[model samples]
Target: MTITPAQVRSALLARREIAIIDVRDEAPFAAAHPLFAAQIPLARIAVEAPWRLPRKDVTIAVYDDGEGLAGQAVAQLRELGFTRVEELEGGLGGWRAAGYELFEDVNSYSKAFGELVEHRRGTPSLPAGDVQALIDEKADIAILDARRFEEYATMSIPTGRSVPGAELVLRAPVAAPDPDTTIIVNCAGRTRSIIGAQSLINAGLPNRVFALRNGTIGWTLAGQHLEHGRQESIEVGDGVDEARARAREVAYRAGVRRIDAGQLADLEAESHRTLYRFDVRQPDVYAAGHLSGFRNAPGGQLVQETDHFAPVRGARIVLADDLGPRADMTASWLAQLGWDVLVLEGGFDGDLATGSDGAPPPRGPEGRYKRPYEGTDNPAAAMQAYLDWEYGLVAQLERDGTHGFFVI
Candidate 1:
């Protein structure tokens, strides 16, 4: 069974559900792939396929450059009960011959959409040196690290607190109570930083906000010091009601819809369309208790890694939160990134699930991509290359016309 690259492109252009899986390890797939291709290495196809491909009936196009893995992958998937599995005809060469866009690095479109957002909005930012200067002078500033808590604990900018993405609007006002205080957001690389800072500005916060330019990569390249092993602490300011209101307004401006529990049940009943339900909150809070059937996807990382979480691009996403603002804020970004997203406004009061989802089985170090923005040890050349890739994404997105991103 096989599907042509043209067919895959048509499906994508029509906004239909399709899973284009690169049946190679992450490292090779990261080197180059179609804009929406998700990596599900041949070796772990069974394990990841069940998790990634929520519906066995959805169309699946497995491909490989020349590794001879696609046939086996198709077999494994069929044995696992996937009913509509097939190989991408001619594999990588097929996509290339068809003249479709190919993107490098992981989370390609999400990162590209971030670049597009910054490009269109002229999202404000500051260099690491300047941010360090503010810290030295004891300037009124609050730095928020928008990456995962584990990433922040590994390394962070001086005086930066782990505030993750979705928490920015919820916690920024609390972190910087004085309107005159500055709020600077940083992530491992540019995407989250830009999205985080812009989240505040979009919500119309009183404090001045800026993304840390090039994020931690630029911070290190500039010879600035980084702190490590700090515990995550975020200030809970006095205005939960105000923050909720601001987040709701932002989502509304971005065209995100709100749904109550009954509406969500209706969405769930639609088996023809894939629906992803996520609790966009911190892991700790989620482990304590989240609405039944909702997976924990902290708002910040969910936006940063939408491709990994939901590979079926046109699939609908419903974000759940007992707290008011997190779902709205997360939905705002997802909507802007061209996702069909909604906030669950009335589901938290029901029976809740407790404990972690348990960490996924690690693929280990064998075939992982060496992401430039991760860790503190990447070479200067790799870091610059990563930033250069990001710089050119706006043009790449333009070339790939399938992206539906819109900036507000």
Candidate 2:
């Protein structure tokens, strides 16, 4: 069986459930592919398929850029009991021939949605030099690094504390208790910074918030220095009551639903539908205890890498958290990005699982695009080019025309 590129676009535009699988190694898959193309390498198909593509009857379209791996992938899926499996008509070339854009980099759709959010919302931001001057003057401000703690510790703005994505709403109040204190959100690049700041603003935090524009890349290009070995992370504070109210309001605005255990069970029993259960909390917290069958997707990173976490674009996503607001805040963004998302209500105290999840199947560095912001030692030219590419994502998203994203 074969599915055409036009049909794929129609499905995405209509917000219909579809998994457009790219059965290439991560490196080559990252080089260029459709915005929603998910990399589930041919070697890992037997293992990853059951987990990522849980619904055997859900539509699955496999494609490759003339490498001829699509046929093998479809064959494997059929053997694995996937009833609706097919190759993309003509594969990746067919998409380009149909005049659809092949976006570069991993998590391409999530990155594009972030750009669209900023474009639609006019999310406020501060350039690296100005933010530096503010820090140098010892201004009444809190610099919240929205990247993971590991990334923040690797290299971050001087004195900035680690506050990953979903933690922005839950932790921002404690980190910047003074309503007058300026709150600066930044990541290694543009998307997280924008999404982090916007999340806070949408949550109605009283403090003035702005994304550190272009994030660490902007800092590097501006000749500003970044600090190393910073170990600070914001604590989950006593602001749960307020955070819950605010986060719920934001989620409501984005049309996210609240689902009880029974509702979730009904969802799980639907063999024809795909459902993803994710515990959106810090890794350590999730490892300590979380509802069974739910994978850990730290809230902020979940939004930053939604396509990776849930490859089926229209799959139902249930986000769980013991604490109040993390799941709600994460759900809000997912809903806005055209996802059918829900927050699992009060499941933390139930029978829970412990221990960290093993890493995903590794795809070696072959054709991967080395993101300029990952390490501290990238050449200046590479860093600038990455930012330039991001600046054009909004335009690309417009041209793609299948992203049903709306920013609140």
Candidate 3:
């Protein structure tokens, strides 16, 4: 069976649960493809197909640019028990012939959505030089690093503390108790910094907040020094009550819903719809104990890397957490990003399962694309090109016109 480009475009506009996969390695797939296409090479179809597309009946369309791999992919997927599989009509050339736009780079749609959020909300930010001057003057500021603790330990701003993105809304009040203290959020690059700073703003925090523009890249370009091996962490204390209340309010405002165990079972029973159950908490805590059948995806990393976690654009996501604040805060962002997300309530009493940290196995080096935004050795030209691409995403998204994202 074959599906045309026009039919696929209509499905996307209708928000149908369809997976348009590019049957090629990351490097070539990143060079050019549809805005929402997920990369799963032909060779790894047997390994990745079952997990990535859990629902066997999901509409799956595989394509390649004149390479004879899509046929093999369809055969492999059928052998794996997929019920509805088809090849994309005309492949990459057909998409072009149908006058559809092709996007470049990995995680293109997620990056584009981030740009749209910034465009719609006008997220505030501060330059590296100005932030440095403030730190030098010993201003009343709390710098919260939104990257993972391991990434923060690698290199970070001089006075910044490790508070991952999902932790900001829950821990910001405790970290900067004084309403007068300025709160600054930073990540390795732009997207998380913008999202983190905006999260606090949306939560209605009283303190003045800003993102470190361009993050560590900006600091390095400005010739500023970054500290290593910082052990600072956000402490949970008497502020837990207030944090939970605030996070619940935010989730409500963002249109996130709550589901009981019975509803989750009903959701699982719908064979046509794909359902993903994730436990958003710290790795150590997840390893200690967790609810049955839920995989561990730390809340912060899940928001930062939504494309990797839920590649199907319109799947249903249910987040689980023993504590109220973490899952609520994470669900709020996911809802605003156009996902059908729910927070599972009251399910920690049964015999807890130990180890299912939802991280995917590492890909072989041959299939990976060397990202230009990572590492210190990237050329000035390449870095500038990456920033330029990000800056223009809002406009590109407008041209593409299938994203149903909104900022709350």
Which candidate model has the greater TM-score, 2 or 3? 2
Q: What are the clashing pairs of model 1?
A: none
lDDT by residue for model 3 over 1-408, one digit each (tens)?
A: 999999899998998988899989999998889988999989888877787788888999899999899999999999999989999999999998988888888878767876777788989889999999999999999999988899898889999998888888878888999999999999877888888898888878999999998888788777889888899988666777777888899899999999999999999899879998888888888889998878877888888777667777789999998877889988988898788999999889888988755555757988888776565667767666777888988888788788777878
| Best TM-score among the predictions, by candidate number | 1
What are the candidates' C-alpha RMSDs? 1.1, 1.5, 1.7
* lDDT, residue 319, candidate 2: 91
* Clash pairs detected, candidate 2: 165-300, 166-300
lDDT of 2 by residue, 1-408 (tens): 799999999989887899999998877887789988888888889988887887889899899888878899999999999988989998988999999988988888888888888998999999998999999899998999999899999999998999999988989999999999999999999999999999999999999999999999999899988999999998989989899999999999999999899999999988767899899999999899878889989988899888778999889999998876999999999998889899989977668789976546645666455778887789999888888888899999888888888888
Ranked by TM-score, top first: 1, 2, 3
Residue clash pairs of candidate 3: none
CA shift of 344, model 3, Å: 0.7
Q: Comparing 1 and 2 by TM-score, which wins? A: 1
Please provide TM-scores, in order, for all candidate models, with all chains considered together: 0.98, 0.96, 0.95
